[model samples]
Target: MMVRFRPTILRQYLLQGQLPTTGCLRSQARLPCIAARNRGAYLLSYAPVRAIHSESTPTASNGPADPAFVPLRKLLKDEAKKQKLSGKKKKKNANNQVVEGWELTVGIEIHAQLNTAKKLFSGATTSFNDHPNTHVAYFDLAIPGSQPVFQKETLIPALRAALALNCDIQQVSTFDRKHYFHWDQPSGYQITQYYEPFARNGVITLQARDGIAVEDGEGISVGIKQIQMEQDTAKTLAQLDNVHWVDFNRVGVPLIEIITLPEIHHPATAAALVKKVQVLLRAVDACVSGMEAGGLRADVNVSVRRSDDPSAPLGQRTEIKNLSSFKAVEDAIIAERDRQIAVLESGGTIASETRGWSIGSTETRRLRGKEGEVDYRYMPDPDLAPIVIGEDLVQHLRETMGELPDAEVDGLIEDFKLTPKDARSLVGLNSGMGVEYFWNVVDALKHRLGSSSLADNLPCYQLAANWILHEFGKLWFDEHEDDAARDFGFTEDGQCARVPVDHLADILFFLYRSQITSRIAKEILWAVFRGRVPAEYASVRDVIDTEDLWFRELSDAEYAALADEAVKGQESVVRVFMEKQEKYPQGKLMFLVGRMMRLGPEERIDPRSAERVMRERIEERYIPRLRGE
Candidate 1:
């Protein structure tokens, strides 16, 4: 049976075209109309028809005697049975086609572990890799008669992040108890700021990307709903045969939950938002922002609605929980969006539930039924008093909030004339430490060169950035191995710690002055990475001398004589250059230059200088012979 809809109404709904609310659908005397309220608007009107069978007459119940009283459930069930009997496959929209009606909406919630030495409200060490439950304290395990206390250090990063995100800092905020039942939650309740959070009403602008390619001049701004400081839950490990173990080490650890408004429409936008948050948290030194290490976690809420009707109510949303990585967040959103679209297309209702992202299969699976706000009976925490952040503290934090990543990137671009890509690369290194190191080396180079500004010397700045991003970054990765290790702690080798900015500056200075070759500069950097540089050698030049890596260029006269000898030896190449002057003059000339560079003195000669000298010889003698002049 075919279901026919009014072309004008259906077209308006399908194309997202606006229609008058009063009479979007025509009222026919024979057909009954059912009005559906959508997003607080009277938007959709449906007319149901009876399915006629070839062998059987339609009954009054099946046809609905009352024109306005159609049973949607029975109609859908009958349609499904009819399709099954006909052995027809479920109709599916083309993969590339925008499901015609649905629009995806996403909101992100991030739990960033605060970088404090001790657990919140306790003196337990917040260190990782300790024995299970080793980091737990009396307050963490909620021992009898134990009371909660506040950690002042946790507020610093949270406030800094708020300021970085341009959130309004709340002077007064209260803590509340969120009650839930879970083995991982030892206290049976969590202390969180539900009634009043620390910060709110902020926005973060993210660069939008089309698939993997970033779109230029296109950005999306998502609102920060709230930021609240809270304690973390313990780690739960389930073994074979339904055996489970709870490690309280993570329990009571400080965390700040950053919740975003449901303005994100694309998965890439959601991922970009999370990555920007990670950078901001790292810039403020509030959170480690390592997804794999449980330093940061994201919960994504996704829903879909009819794109054609702006006033259509959103479809039932599913919450994808504990998405540990940015990629997982993006993938989960995309997968869930497709799943919802398929369900709706197949005439199935979307279920509200909590889902888990299957990293192995890249799909979201049901974790539990969805819970509402009322489920978590929230009340003010009696153990801890309300936090009153004074103007003095806020002003001090604002003052001490070091250079954020955006500002630093702009500075690099404006000062060094670097591309946005290069500037972001430099400022985005080691959570801004890489840029700091680059500038430190630049300062040293400026002082040694007796120059007032490194910016005026563009070559110096470019060379410094290249070395830092390529060579120094490689050395750092080799030592630290992973992002968490590099960001948090160094290895036992102590190589990274030993190489000072001055060492790199001295090496760059030598290269700038042509005192050493690029190859020699790299060798010196390798030596620094390997801890081979002795304390006696105060600079890279000294180390170069000791290692016999210094390559002094030959004098002009000596180079000219060597060029002459190279031309005489490469007699065939010179003849080719003369014969093919009109066809491959430049190429044949470069061949002679290569011969000159290879046959010259042991001293390293610049390739550009060799090319120039070769061109001069060909023009002065070889070209004249070839042209018969």
Candidate 2:
């Protein structure tokens, strides 16, 4: 049999110094206690009958008797003091010397907006820059009789992101209500996966860069606590005079929040980790990952502790919130870490609080006291049912998971024998489109060159990479200098709109064969990009012929005659070379070659060829006479 006891009756009995003789009297189960006046409800988990032997409790000798009550105020105060002292002790050594410096510990929470046509829970279009509240629906406004309908489009990208991060995707996950009171949150609760996240136990390994602890070719791994799907809040516009405005168009947009463990030791490591996530998300088409437009942002939690004390508990962390840029994230972590160390070293305690990153000043400003888990009052949402992933769904997502950034980078390094830096630059092209364009050009060149292997054609690969990254990249950027949203070689619809990949390959092919100099190649590229070249001239050779830009190597007889004329024209230089042959042999010969190239040709001549012919003529004809041989 089961019995229930009202909390009021239990509280009265405890206050009256009476022990109930009934079921669960000796049980260790927690019982709720409701108190009168200023005291609120509390749970009494340890109710020992031995402490209350008699119905009437004995009065204290030095104070009024209240034997049933134990005030938690003094106990909490003592615990706080003990914890503070323990933290301080860890900063000192056996000689009681304070440690020279503190270690910085950082963790980041990234919120990436999922790419979809509609809002996550409503049918409103997800287009940006619409009139304020124009795209909002009844569900987005959280009206009296409205409910959210989940969007299936959000799951694919979310799953792809989980796989990219090496996360363990859960077969089953549930949503919860994260309660908070804010004007921006019209619903007063955000629908998020709090109890069981979609994925967990993931890792993101970052290659060492500037300000990070690890060296080049070395990496540091950070643990991913979880990745959860959550709804975005409305954008608050506080710059208006006398009234604040809210934009609900962004409300109900889907986001996947990736929470990392506190393993970062430097600001740069955190930034690098964020950048890696951005690249992965973009590669998988999970998000646009635009920080400036608020598609991606980070909340960085920073703390400082003694580097010597690995076992010591971490210092009270201050979270720098809503850092929209990588530079802001890194700078904010650095500033917060320094502030925390300065506080501890000056005999002050670090407060557990939430801070705002001041982008302009590069500092962290106090926002609010940190909130505990209980403060949110999380509960499973009754409206939405739990989602279950079957084997078929997981298999489909895995099968379609395209090449991620790291894998692509490694492939470029191995197959093309490109350096890690160059390979990384290629994979990082236009958030991976550059890689697509690069390989497309390579394949086209292979067909043209009658080669079946990229590895077999190292020169072609090198030339393609160099021209695409340096020359083509410059032209692409220059064409879209005013449009920040323009992607390389792609239109807004994601079509290949810039110079065709095949055309670029033809240009590189001509360059590889030395039929045209780099200057002519660049000019041909620009002409094609600007549509100045006619369609009939499809290949680089045709373009060179049509535009009359082909360069010719000088014939030996022509070069001999030109060199003789150049020596006669620059007699002073020839005399100097003859007088000081030991000091200026090669230099004097090259001077004659340069003068001959300038004076001999209406058509451009190859400089190297001219130099060779000039050297042969001078050594056989001029040098013999100069040395009296």
Candidate 3:
């Protein structure tokens, strides 16, 4: 009767007034750390840390967990059972991502810092350039008396991201505390959406231009598994003198983790998917901070399999963490894939693990063994309530969100007869302003001609796009770089100070309509960009006239004199022209034409007219003389 309630080992330690140290916690080796602040995104750098990997269940060493945490235990148990039953993984043609018989499968988790004005739960302004630790509030420090006050407005950007990806938004989504011990985390746990995320089941279609060929014209689409809003951790600097530097300014900054399905096969497609997501987020004004600015970080999941047997299972996957650039994403995946293939070929087991990219080595190195879900005790957040928004808010966001970059690219191709490269170039300009400017220039050209169509099948829109992106873009980039001459520079305020759209249209109009030669037209355009023009002229014709740049024909006397001088100056060319003896001897006659056009201002005369005069002179003088007449 007295032994009916014998205690278990962990319970005996607890009942004997002794708190057993958590197995995972007992291995902790956290060193004292410091903070750093960066611009653009809240986080600047992540410090290296040894991650804990434990197979056993956690025993109580601290206070009781919120009851809501226990609800997810059953789900974890079920997932474990399912994984045991489903033992293997599988992928695609994968180009060079693998050797001929091997296939590659990759999934990515992108953490993009939101552009909201405030932190997710605190009133601290979400400015990245602030002093380290100055932006943190009491709750951010996990102070006992101060609790997290939810900021409902932060969800607006998260909503935009969901709608942009065409994800199904949950009417209600709850947050959970992911418990882990890291030097950067002031709190023992991180508040995130684990059990029930806000959005799910969307797709992004990739195009051939994105480096992935459209298979049978069906197009490659990457599935959006879920998009969950969560809090970002503090910026951590790599250990210096055995001490870590931490920037609490980034602590609790709002971040949305967008998880993609394991559908990517090629490294190119994986990088493209990340870039497309970046474009989508920026298009919706959700995440304006670019990847270069530390606004986004990606974790790439890579797995490989042998295709010799169709039913053969995929190899274990390795997770490559914190990739900031597209090149890094692709390179890291390639390295990891090669590593796994080597291991499999050598009869070595591929262990599931977490790895890091070494930029200097251009390879991947193991960080730690992958941690299971139970390793991170998911407890319901006791302070923050579930995020709930109405249908009306969703409708409003949908109405306000701009057209996606891909849609704009297709529109440019179909409506304006633009090439894929040209369309993407325009869409990438000035945060979509380039596309708008392109349309404006096209309209201005049409208006000047008083007709929508150009003579001789001129691609009016295509010409405009080329000049804008190629010619102007060249000068624009130069203005920001080693521009010594400062020709066609930006405005004093460090802006592009672009020449008016109509001004560019004028140049395009003059060039296409044959009112001015192509070389002359470019000169006039530069003058306008350089602000050398006395005033903004009404049209290209006006600019040409005001600048004395109009193409002028040679007078009859001038043409005869110039032709005589050209054929006499290039005696060899005339001999070649006469020897050929064909009616025009077109190829040989080019030397004479080029010589005549080089006479001072005669360069402004159209090459066609010069060619005609030179040919006539050659026919009247050189050809007859060679025949011994």
Q: 1 or 3: which has the higher TM-score?
A: 1
> lDDT ranking from best to worst?
2, 3, 1
Q: lDDT tens digits, residues 108-226, model 2?
A: 89999998888878888885665455577788877789998988777888998998899999999999999997666768899999989989999988774322444213787889999
Worst 10 residues of 1 by lDDT: 46-55
Q: Candidate 2 local accuracy as lDDT?
A: 0.74
The lDDT for every candidate, in the order shown, is 0.72, 0.74, 0.73
Report the lDDT tens digits of candidate 3 across residue range 149-195. 87888899999989999999899999999998775677888899988
Tens digits of per-residue lDDT for model 1 on 461-499?
Answer: 789898877776676667435554344222222213546
Candidate 1 local accuracy as lDDT? 0.72
Return the clash pairs for model 3, or none.
34-245, 34-246, 35-246, 35-247
Against the correct fold, how does model 1 do in TM-score? Answer: 0.74
lDDT for 202 in candidate 1 is 90
TM-score for all models, in order of appearance = 0.74, 0.74, 0.73
